[model samples]
Target chain A: MDKPALAAWLGAEITGMALLSGGAIQQNWALDVLAGGQAQRWVLRTDAAATLAVSRSRAEEFHLLRAAHAAGVTVPEPLRLCTDRSVIGAPFFIMRRVDGLAAAHRVVRSETLAGGRQALVAALGRELARIHSIVPPRADLPFLGEPASDPCRRFVAAMRVLLDAGRLPRPMLEWGLRQLEISAPPPAATVLCHNDFRTGNYMATEAGISGILDWEFAAWGDPHEDIGWLCARCWRFGGPGEVGGVGPRAPFVAAYEAASGRRVDPARVAWWEIAAAIRWAVVAIDQAERHISGAEPSLELALTGHIVPELELDVMRAVMARAA
Target chain B: MSWDGHEAPDTRALLEIARTTLMEAVIPALTGDARFKALMVANAMAIARREDGPAAAAVHAAVRELGDVAALCAAIRAGAHDPGSADHDRIAASLRALAEARCRISAPKALG
Candidate 1:
């Protein structure tokens, strides 16, 4: 935004900066700088003008990145956080730039990028395990508030509020919530979960994961959620492999279990998978509502609503399987 | 383009033609983001075309007869239509049927 002021703040000569294509939630700029005659490449992340409700703020995300990076989670090395609005008009953070394919389709299909399917899947499982290694009640991540006492029921309650607010009644989502509410799991230990742990969110070169890119949705939740999210059908990009369309569920869970030293429960993961479907359905409707209500007229958002039926179908199948 | 009932193509037919042209001719020439946008346009056209006619309308009527979505959802939440109850099966069936109808228009491949 304000290049001169940013340069002064960093005390580095800004050679070039260009906005990256992704990050609808946040605006990412690929930046190059010459600091003390040393060339450096980095990415700057800042909040978009119209922010979504669920994601953490730039300041909060910085804390999350710090914690995640500290815990050995494969994330971009969070370098500096500029909180002064005057420097760039909004809070922004800079991190090391990672090069790899993060596109969902490409990441799922590319032989070169994904490396070996089992190896990559195992690596991702280990990455998720590292993310979950960061337990709650940490002083650094105070912005996350408190861990959900019962993440499943908490999600169901929140989804009900959102579904009602949608105005256009979604019976399918309601049904799924009803099923989820009754089947709420007993409270267990909470861990820091990457709520959006799916294919497109992480970058990898060959078989080695460069970094986990999206951190805005990181919060204290059930570890199974991140697991289910990774295994969620909607996130598969039509690839048949169970783990982000990369491999089967058994090895992924085995890897997570071996890495995290926590028992991986298939039933709990199944329940959260339903929650994931409902969660995406709610978000898809909300995104589409932005277009439908004329708040944001974009073809992408408009077509997002059409995806609800498929997600709803997913919910029904999963919920029914969990039924009496 | 008169509505003179003299072999006039319906709106659904027009949308089908547009989507077919987009998929077969126009979209093949597009790449990257432009191609993605064209695919979305084609998908929207297909959805709109399928949403027309009595088959789609009949689903609304059937679901309405079962009850509005809100009431049905409320009933579900209250546990009035418990799992094995007659009303549970009926309501679930109706909702499933409605969802399937929506899939027919929005994402038929997703149904199977």
Candidate 2:
């Protein structure tokens, strides 16, 4: 990672550095440094060799994190951003490291954590509310572009383009998109939608959630999309909890409503849940293509393709269940 | 591998044995990310074995009965099977059946 150059940039002595495993699109390193004789632990996030088409750059993510933090969302404090590629061979951002496990299965079943399940869900609800408070027209987030008049339709259109670009035809996904297209909901209030908000993305400890992570996919869209992405069954990770595989939907929605001062819409969230499934399927295929095309060549990426069938079935089931 | 009956093992036999060894012996001894990678390897092998096996005949017939997937895809995008269309329900049913067939191979546990 060119530790010497990084140490020079930070004006610190590197005590230790190691690559942390996780985040397929971005590589994270546990970076410990001694600056001014004060020790600090930080995580350096940088672009991987290959990344998903939708992922934002490190600088953009740093801005998003700054906006979230300014909005009072619990997130790892984004410390510094380096856009120069020569710093570490890629643009990178370093954030203060927060302690806790972000694993979905363990977080769902955790007993040592204080405040139990409902409290944690409520915390996340408030966190999401705070995030959604960041609307468009911000000079800081100019890269988010103009807010879409109809984010749902735009999403389906974008997915169609991506699907057509894919190697094989996905009739199931096409069918799902067709259903979503016909039932496209009226545009709700535009807010910062955490496009990847789901289980296993946040760190939790005995005290509760330490920080909400993974903001690279943040965009200006219907806030219900974030809610649906959180409550999506596929993100449930085999856990029964409806909210990020941790708690029920009612409490989370209630908490969000109380925090956001916006009425929670069940139907819109349901629609976004279908969108979430299709999005996951498309991204999974893209990730697997990285392996199958010999770009990534990792076992994890190969196994991800196997997840598409389950996603296809989920979309079909949702379509049939909601069919007139 | 060819199935010449000299017991050199065909693809299915090879994957099953290799995955069994990986799961039963190798995975038990590994730890952390290595263990996770090994498990994924085992799962990939299992999926490969399933893919090598016969796919659902009904799925093949469904593809033949409905249009080819590419035609079906274009037909869908063109609103040929939109709601209130004559062939909407039939096409939806066929799509669901095909999705289930895929589930049977890639993730049988996902099938209801």
Give the top-scoring candidate (TM-score).
Answer: 2
Could you list the iRMS of every candidate? 1.1, 0.8
- The residue-by-residue lDDT of candidate 1 on B1-112, one tens digit each, is 5577656487988888878888999999999889988988988888888889665886677677666667777888887776877777767767777777778778899877
In order, candidate lDDTs are: 0.85, 0.88
Question: Which residue segments of model 2 deviate by more than 4 Å?
Answer: A111-114, B1-8, B56-58
Chain B alone, TM-score, model 1: 0.82
Across residues A49-88, which tens digit of lDDT does each residue of candidate 1 receive?
7799888889888888888899998888999998899898
Evaluated at residue B67, the lDDT of candidate 1 is 65
Predicted complex 1: CAPRI docking category: medium
For all the predictions, what are the DockQ values? 0.73, 0.83
TM-score of each: 0.95, 0.95
Candidate 1 segments whose C-alpha is farther than 4 A from its true place: B1-7
